[model samples]
Target: APFRMSFAASAKHVRVLENAGLVRRKVHGRSHVIRLNPAPLAAADKWLRYYERFWRERLDTLEALIRAEDKAATRKRSRK
Candidate 1:
């Protein structure tokens, strides 16, 4: 069939996905149904979220410094 993968290839991919904890499958009469399990993905997301707050605080400090410099430059220009 055109634009369709063979069942063997699809099954291999499904197995790989299952091993990665990204998917689960059930065999039906002639075809298999696949479902995604987000637990692993969620754990990764949570890990990244923990770092996001830390980076945000650092970026906020940088922004404050930039603004302070901008204000100082404006003050100096006014004195010219």
Candidate 2:
């Protein structure tokens, strides 16, 4: 399905995307063609993956610490 928007709103959104290096616009007479530039998106994906891995590792360490503490608490309660 084709997307629909007001010309002014569309132009504003296109300008933002163009500035971000995510889209390119080519004008031919009265017509304009917009194309996706994938390089910027690929770079963004790579950066996100790096941080995702970093957070995953930190969360795993936190889970392990919480489990260990819970086990110690259980043992202490049993002995009391």
Cα error, residue 13 of model 1, in Å, equals 5.2
Each prediction's TM-score versus the true structure: 0.65, 0.92
Point out where model 1 deviates above 4 Å: 1-16
Q: Write the per-residue lDDT of candidate 1 for residues 1-80, one digit (tens) a residue.
A: 76399978977988999999999888899877899999999999999998999899999999999999999999999999
For model 2, residues 2-80, the per-residue Cα lDDT tens digits are 6687878889999999999999999999999999999999999999999999999999999999999999999999999
Candidate 2 ranges with C-alpha deviation above 4 Å? 1-4
Each candidate's lDDT (Cα)? 0.93, 0.97
Candidate 1 Cα deviation (angstroms), residue 49: 1.5
Against the true structure, candidate 1 reaches a TM-score of: 0.65
lDDT of 2: 0.97
